[model samples]
Target: MKRSIKRLVAFVFLFLALNNTTAQSIPDSLAQKIDKLFSQWNNPNTPGCAIGVVRNDSLIYAKGYGMANLEYGIPITPETIFHMASVSKQFTAYSIVLLARQGKLRLDDDIHQYLPWFPDLKEKITIRHLLNHTSGIRDQWQLLAIAGTRLDDVITQDHIVKILSKQQALNFKPGEKYSYSNSGFTMLAEIVKAVTGQSLRRFTDSAIFKPLGMKQTHFHDDYTEIEKNRAYSYQRKNLFTFSNSVLSYSNAGATSLFTNINDLSKWVMNFYTPVAGTAADIDQLVQKGKLNNGVELNYALGISSDTYKGYKQYSHSGGDAGFRTYLTVLPELKMGFMVFSNLAEVNTYEKTYQLVDLFIKDTSAKVNADIRMDSSRAIIKDEGRAKNFTGDFISEDGAQFSFVLRNRKLYWERYGNSDLLYPGLKDSFTVARSPEIKFVFSTTPGKSVLVNQYWPDNKRLLVKYATDSIQTDNQLQMYAGLYYCPELDCKYTIVAKDHELILTSNKYNDSKLKLVGKDHLFTDYWWMRHLKTISGNNKKIIGFEVNDGRIMHLRFNKIQ
Candidate 1:
């Protein structure tokens, strides 16, 4: 009886010691608040996330919210591995930085030096351009999609090289613009192979992951390779269903990264503490891109440098198949936040920031609200001036937009989709759906310009070209037919019904074409913005090329 009483007393003391240790690690109140924030995801039947918070290079809080694999009823833990998607870019960028540090390659060296088989295209695209995503190379996935390969297809590096090599044009001149191109990073991975005589996966495993003590982290280059504790990705279309990533893991640059929150915490700490590379090497990794006009872009080598709630944030987000991820670091504050989700529905971007806010103290600052109503009360709406603003405007990068005054309302049309603009104060107009997006028109004749006042400090100006008109029925009918793009291995059908033209593709839903220019067609979809008619022998309507933000001119031949 005395021995039993002594054992009970020891058990009570041990429990108290553990409770004190937990309180010391993180306040119980703070831990509860974090738990409540993710309470919605705390379900065993649903796939969820593993999150971690770092304070001064140490993981202070790490937890798993829901099931990692619903099929087996496995709960998500900090060790559950997930596909990182585009978040893999930073690691790929680090590989290039290491190469530069070793004096094997220079960032300013032309990419053709490493990739001799690559088409010249008369552009001086350097390694730095590729790292910063300013190379202006068309996105690889879009190129593959145009070439008849879907995003979910098993595409290898060789497939990407073959498709990109055949391309005769670029989206723009290198360093001329800042458009995120995954093709550049793919090329960077190839460059690493050429210089180091090692695959990107093998090289990073030794240099970055191993040195940083990220045992669970590696460039996932082989889908067939078995990994323990891997969380299966899932998507809910009609119901929650298991969906395997169809993308080939052989490619190691743009995507194809698998890691867990615990392993990623070590990598996050490496950003603040030097272990894998020198300070100079890390500096190169975070250096922002520069445009030809000497303007600096927000995108650094593989990451993006931006501000969040007045705190400087170096961050990146990733989405592929059913995986969604977010990683943000505040170097100044020595704080970092990471969220890895296997479920597509999880808004990791917003949720990760909310997690960051939980740890960081809020300043209670607010943005000054714009008083549009008070500013416009005394101003009379000018119909004549609005009508005079009707004209096609083109940007330096060839993005065209048109202003049309119809039924006493001004509509801003770009590519073919029209957005009705409501008068704000003077020549400024705001989109009803997006009041933050303002269209300010220049009042001076012959100097009329349409400024898209979005993305503060990065506003784009569209110069007036000439008055544009809609296409006639005859012109629309001539181009109507079944069109086949041999590259995309896809067919597009144009149907004329009720004096309106409709574009139908097997991959996407039917969209009505709006004539934006003589040969340019626009649709309500933002991605299908640039559709240009292509002519065959004897100037007969043959097909059209679809080009947009990421895709370049992909031609479709006329058939039937």
Candidate 2:
């Protein structure tokens, strides 16, 4: 009887081992879906993408879609290396937290403690502020462009400091608000250098990447250095044309880390298993925090913590000139999803959210069919008369915008930015680095132009443009002073300069605007050109609004 029982037990064990091996294998259904998605992305007009999905610390899916290099006809694969833009933030943040764990530095320490050549901006910004994006530092990318820095030029941490030192003021008081600032993270990368006496890349590689067994990941600076299985970045112009653009690796903190999904799966496992750093260090990395005065903040060091579709989600996204990527983890389910694309055609956030929603809400159901619209052809339009829509339209939230008539076409401009003229779309225009927006004009005859605005990601709004002259009075003057939104942590100083309304933000020097109506002004700036004021009582402007759902009220006192 004992011999029979031992033989039965061995047979059962063997059957279970084979069953587990089969389960670990990629299912045919999933493989087919991956193939379909890759085919869609691989179209000559679409940007190439790399995707990675981890299930319980194992990479269940790691594949590349589209061409990494169109010129070479090189096909992307799971091993292809793509630039992980802001996704590098988490690693940089982890390095800082690791150093803090080792008694090398403190999060609350002022940035000047390590780099004293910083600007004298009155506010004592700490490393915590940098991590949480509460430091009101202007973006170095804008500064670089303004200073005539080339896109391909190599910029170091010290170069960023030199630009910051010349800046006159912060966007707001340090730690007063939370705004996404790549400049803050870049500075942290420099601080990692100053504190550890080693390059940020070297330290991260030795301390984190190596220890985590992420052998395929490296800090990339030059595109010429050939790495094994690196994917070429592509920009899909249409269905048949793609352009090969230079992959950005010059910026390390804000961008420039080459990696693959196979490695990222292991990296995600570290969140729960704690590989290179201690469990305590991992906790610190994901620890939630609020401001000193008790304002809730969503960002933790490098990762953004939020609840999505009934799951606690920690994730970050990266986008450069030609590439886009996302890394998200659901600790409750012990599952993580990452998608990297050489082309920037797909919205990683929307796609990932939809997939997670499908899995959590109804695993048996497929993703919504309407969610799969071709984004390239989607354009918003205004239904009103072309001549009436030619006035300035400002955002109620203080972003300046403009609309002009040139060659019978309506052109849209933002914040002293240049007008993007649409020759045929009537009320629709496209902005650079942004999705297309359209204006639907109201049917009111002989009245000011009122139109609905449509944005990408399925947001819509109605906007009114005044054709009459703006009332110049004391009340309007009171609202004219510089207003700042502490929540957004951005400042807009509205001053009447040289007979034109001037709206100035920290990023741009300032733009001159022509006040064409009661609550509207026009400029030629690239990002924002229209300015609209929201009135409260007695036709008095109480707050300003922008097209991007940002509202700055009259309550924020003038800086002077």
Candidate 3:
């Protein structure tokens, strides 16, 4: 009788929830609610976001909050220009698609066929691979930062090409997996120039902007070129927010898009209506990516496809320097959302969903921001078992982390931060702070023992390794030397001081390193976190490869 009563109550709650989500708000109230959602940034003294709502073929609503230029007291409006960062990717992708339609280049052709300067990584990288971000090329920004190139130090398109041309390896075999690499898009832009004898900005101007009548939209290839009524970006700091922006990017393809919500609303409308490309060309834009092993990915050509609240959706977001941008399209409802901000702290993705809930009349209850509570759960405890999982670990895709036994408890450690791990079912554990993450340890047959990790976005198999406590002073000296990476055009010197290792670079502070099992290394520095010693045939340490999250196995050879 109790079970029957519980089931009845559950059904009643579900019906109520569905009805709540289905409820419709009046147009006036919806607008007011949307404004209230952005009330935090509605002040005149702060940096803010410009929003646009397009329903079907028409832009029904458009507004901006806060200041565009805090120094000048310039109020933000729908016409305020924003650097659309990666949201500019779709335009780059569409340009490639249009070129294919014109018989200028085939999508399946190898990238090397056009740009002969790029090194042969012994894999076929097609234009399609570049478009879908499955080419396994390292991200350009990661490569640059690893090489000690300051982002604010006048980076140009030619510089990107120069750096990418010398890349010695791939993150993975082309089409083997999907990794978002900005280098792929930069190469795509290079392909456009190589084939059409015109820059991406020039080609896109003629092919897309002109046809759509988007006069305010253009790729800001030259950062020096100033546009009228442009918003000055800002970074949040304790010493006041003004004078903090110093982004000089003279590049196209991957980023450097200058646009306004009014101009961007037209681009959002282009996805559903006959605004930019033909019907057939438009069909190619939303096709999802597929890996070699037949696993379909959410990433499409320059955009991503997913379902939100039972409604099929397409979206893409971008962030560079102090700029943030997000664009979303729900084709079922023929509705689109655009949020572009000039401040680094602006949560554009968060604002997009809040606007979505209001404009789409969503009924889901609000989540408490101050409290983080997991569903009903408890952890099992054992001291000996916790100690067994303690060690440095690395995933197959080059993700590095460690587990430490502290005060009779196991804690997950990565990049100098440690999270207490709670014991669970035998050989299983959950993170104390993030209960959603689970780790299971087991011994496999023959050669491999695995720590199976389940996180929000990925599931990885990590293998434990021992630290370099076994290495003597003589062994540590072998790794000491000055090294150079031709691809990054940067130099690094590894120093051995009193049997300890320290990495010194001209543009960066010294980072203390911890050697791991055999050839691997761990460091606190962002770029040098995961390093593996490159060994010569004569059993001498020749160089090392770095894996800094997005860029994998970047070679830094011994110079001395």
Candidate 4:
């Protein structure tokens, strides 16, 4: 009896211990929540996504859902590589700083010192301005399109400099306001080339990629070099099919980074502990810059640092035609998360934040003020004012468009492409195909209306609206003149042709636009819109405006 009792006690103790061990090793319920969030992308409209979460230098969860290459039935995984797009900016900025530390270059040096052929703006713009996006240089991609350059053509540093040199003015005064310009970063890439005598790909490989042991990461210059374990980029088609698209590598600094989540996790670690450079050098790279009055610029060299839900956060996002990505680091909590998608229309940022919030147990975590949207006002029944609101509203880029009312219905267009319209819950409309866009229409005075487009997924683009007036004059004779903005050193000559207004800019072909209202013109493409007669003096037109709020006033000498 004694022997049996001792054996029974031993068996009971062993059972209890095993039960406790199993419970401890099991993943938390939060893991299930994360799985559910990712599963949402498995639908036809949503794109496939890869996600990774790190807690205290350890990977807590890593998984991919749906298909990376739907045509081939390939699945997305944490190791699948995707184009990082603008997220590559931080890496580019770091490379510049590394070169600066080696005495090869100075951040404050004038760009012309490196690229001697660069345009001579009236004001001297320095490398510091480029790094901080205060260079006032016009966006190169837009300029290229205007200059009749093909989007797929290889653009070199010299090409960029040639274009800038010919530019008579800037988009704004240097160091006065902040505008996100890809041209600035492209210039920095040139400076890197001038100093190191090495292409950006080689320099970064030697200085950053190899040092960090990021063997899977690369600049993606040539697609022919078969990349092992690279995720094929995909675009959603009709909720079932996904099409593949190729992105060029000529835009290495501004975009064209091919990487996976595992590599990005290591990159995030460098933010906490410097691996390639000294602590001081790292601080200089990540430290936020400020204006003369000590106000924070809200952007670091390449990364953005801000407060979210009372916690200091650093994050960046990237998007191209076929891929989207996001990386967020919460340094104080020693946690970071990254998400990548092979298909477009994925909410990588939101999904990333949800995972981070679950891990941190911060239910109240909020995004920065600049990214969040204000709550929509309650909708009211149409009070006989619907007729006044019926008209066409256009974008400055001549690509984005919206119609106020048609058969008592509202609609919007993306880049002038016709897709079925989706009904918004309130006084709004959206693309039945795109889940990210929302259009809100409101009435104004004098048969005019206001239309606002809300892109909740795109943090970089604020909600844009246009006020339309029907009293606009369609006659082009009165609007013909040479309009100039000294601040930008740019000129526009308006000419009438075939009942349409043609705007001709330096190095750009004539843009044929139809006058829809007194001062408004709509183009064949939806991204471009024009507002003329912004300034009037006794029935004389003075200036015109672009969609981004840039105004070009006519010179007194040129106006008739």
Candidate 5:
């Protein structure tokens, strides 16, 4: 009778535990609303995303929307594998940290100790610098673009290494500033190769993916290797149609991770609970980077340490070709959210934020701080006078922006994106997206007034660049010349064609130049935009320099 009573008590406790779990389960209404959030992509024709929400060890919500392959009419599911772009970095980082734990490599050790092929750029670049993106290396993509290599081409690991070998300069002193460079992560992959006899793909497979039971995840090194249920990426051609965004990357470390929502949930849950790695290792992975001067950086090893709606959050976003992926983890709440898309136009970060709002309450600090900053700005009451700010402006660093008057509001424009500019202090203004960044207009009595951009960390002065003065064909013809860059061993010839300067590069592609100001020009090339003409002692055009923000001054000499 006593043994039977004990059994009955145990059964009753189990029943109550199950009941409690059911009680805490998400409401059907809430789950339906979540379904409604992704209902737009629940069609046969559209490329969609796989969304996953993890609470502690359980993936409470896991769903896929839209077609994985439009040609075969295969709808997306949690099991479908998708190529993760820069989101691949986190895995590479974990591999490196695991290696460090094994005493195979040290994070503080100079990268030269492992990869001797990398040039010594006067400063000692540590392994930490590469992981933190503080290595002062110029971005591999930009370097390839400047050298006339198309991104859509089959760019391999060897090609990146070859290009990096040819680079004779660094972006800045190592660990001096935080500049995001995909090249650094690729170098980290090389270091792994040098330290260990295995390739990054093989190492990560044995060390991370397999151990975590992440069967769907791998560092996709072989582009030709066919996998079952692989999803194709697409971009919106218009509101009515879509086009394929081809990604031919045999590259690893920096990108080329293939995973699914189900597999990714396991990884996210591991961040909160020790499933594959120890809690101490996760602590090391999430630790923020510090500069040479000890200024803490927001970027940790691979992920970014930041806040969302006033809560401490660790997150990262990836974009390559048409693949958009975002993973955010709130360890305190034991919650993780991820949105992986096969479409370029999908704002995964914003969508994840919207989804998380259903579970996490808003913290007042981040929102209030933003409001205080905006509220402190002096507003412009007069619309007529705002027109004076509408003009092209170029920073001393060769970065260019334009101020335009649109619908009686002042906007700061760059590339194709625009942000509203609100007046701040005396002759100062703040951008809508970045309130801390102020464009303070200053005039030294008789000198031409310039806008001094005061960012939280750095300052840059920008001068007005008038495009109206060069209205004649004669003015355009004078800037036409032949220039040669020794770094890439390529020559560029400029010819005046139909009131515009047409550029023909010998080594790569070419584009027409748009005149910005005297002896200055811009181009359609995204990486290397500015073409500032250099003059000799005889007042003749000697060369031109292209500064794409990262690469400060790359000079192309006049050969003919």
Candidate 6:
């Protein structure tokens, strides 16, 4: 009987040890939370995303959450290929870095050294300026849009080059300010072709992808090239509908890259472990851009350097047609994640960050501001005080804002959206849901101004309109005519309609012009404001000139 009791005791100890081991080896619950986050896309009938997570040079998790080929009933897998729109910029930037390292080209060299056909704008735009978007060249896509080309239309590199070649001016001087321009990148790709005998696709395929063993990756320049396992892009109307990337696949630098999560994960891992490029080349690829004034911008060569919840992040997001993609890497944490989706509506950035939260430790202690202005804290007593802030305000950068009083409340309106302001102190108010934005109104006559206090050191003052009234419709008719801008090869027609002046352009939608001064007008379009009409020696209408932040004093000749 004693022997049997000892045997039972031994069995009980084994059971306890087994339970401890099972508890130690249990899978992390974070994975389940991530799976739940993608629940909407975890179906066989909808377009979804392919995600991959890498840590210390290994892919810890890779999965797909929706239909890759809806018609064929093929479920998305990690290997499913997706078009990464602007995310392709990084690879293009890397190609430039590689070429620079090979001594084939110099970053500071003038672009005219290679593309002599380019107009001499009398500006010193270097190759580095193009890579970092400081060249001041108008965006290629925007220029095309201004020239009556739509995004859905098929546009090739030659078509963009033709438009760029005819341009005689830039938005700003090189390196004077930072404006995101796709034209710079397209030019960079052309430089790559000019320096090397082959195309960007062939050069990168042999130089980068082949060396890294990424077989499914390439800068797809031909839309007709049949790619296996390619996931079709889609958008939801009443139901999911296939959206073709109608853009010509001939562009290589600014966009046009076809890759899969499996291959992209390899690219992310390269940031941690060097293989395709040398350490210096990789460093240059991610270095932040500096302006002429010595101010550094968050944008690097192709990626954006930022912070998320206390960790430093190098990331990029892309959207084109029905494809949306995001890729982020936390170099300090040695962790990276990529989400590529064929559905345009997917918030890939939010989803990727949510997934990162599960895997990374959160050490952020940042708190929201505790200051709140409620009815009990109200200090303003005069109802007329609200009127002091009501009017149009113009900033130095040509950005316009409107303050309106409605329903006994003050609202800050921009781009047709209103944000109710909370009264803080006398002559000062704070924007709701945005504690960082504060407005102070100075009611001095002729010198009245509205000061916008955004960041701690960033303050912008907008001069208040002192004029009592605008010009009458009879006076507005004098400016009505057809005006042509030779630089853009586009025309603007001003017509008097409904007691106001309506400006119509074949390239852009019609906009109503509001008379702010004797001969000056403001449009709802913020970028194109501060317009002044000119007259000939005979007192007949000659044309007008637009003085904006980017395009300063751009003139148009009156043809009718």
Best by TM-score: 5
Candidate 5 vs candidate 6, TM-score winner: 5
Poorest lDDT segment (10 consecutive residues) of candidate 6: 17-26
Q: Each model's TM-score, in the order given?
A: 0.80, 0.65, 0.81, 0.68, 0.84, 0.78
Report the lDDT tens digits of candidate 3 across residue range 508-542: 88888887666777777765688888899998999
The lDDT for every candidate, in the order shown, is: 0.78, 0.66, 0.81, 0.65, 0.81, 0.77
Clashes of each: 6, 41, 0, 21, 0, 0
Give the lDDT of residue 356 in candidate 3. Answer: 85
lDDT of 4 by residue, 1-560 (tens): 99998787556534532321111221768656777887666532334787887766555667677666554545566777888988888888989999889998888787889977676767878877777776777776666654455555666655666676666667666666566777788777778888889877888999999988898998776545777766666676676566665554455677778888778877777777768776777677767755433455767787787766566678888887678889888777777889888777777888778777776654355545353322232122463554443445554333345444454443444455554444555556555555477666665566345666655311121123344432333546677788665533556677876665777766556778666545555544322344435645676677665543222221222344
Q: Which stretches of model 3 miss by more than 4 angstroms?
A: 1-26, 239-243, 361-392, 396-461, 467-479, 497-500, 514-525, 535-541
> How well is each residue in 1-560 modelled by candidate 2, as lDDT tens digits?
99998787566544532322112246677656655655566433344666667777687766665556666545566677778888988999999999998899999998999878776678899999889877867666655543445454667656666776666666557776666788888788889889988878899999999998899997775555778777666666777687775654455776788888778888888887778898788778877656656766668888898666667778999887677888998877778887787776768776665545434553233546443433333332432456666665544433445666654445676656654443334444444334365555554566645556654322233445555654565434655676654433456677764445676766666777666546555556533444556666676665564322211121333454
* Candidates 1 and 4 compared by lDDT, better number: 1
TM-score (C-alpha, index-matched) for candidate 4: 0.68
When 4 and 6 are scored with TM-score, the better candidate is 6
Give the alpha carbon lDDT tens digit for every residue of 1-560 in model 1. 99997787566534532332111267889878877778777655567788888888678888887777776766777878888999999999999999888899999999999998788899899999988888878888777764556676677888888887877678778887777888988899999999989999899999999998899888888777888988887887556454544444567799989998878888887777879998787777888888887787889999998677777778999998788999998877878899888888889998898888787775547765553433333233777877767877765334877888776777779877987777876678877555778877775565555565554224566666544466678877987899886754668788988888998877776889876545666766555566877776787787787767776566777887
Kindly provide the TM-score of model 5 when superposed on the true structure, using C-alpha atoms. 0.84
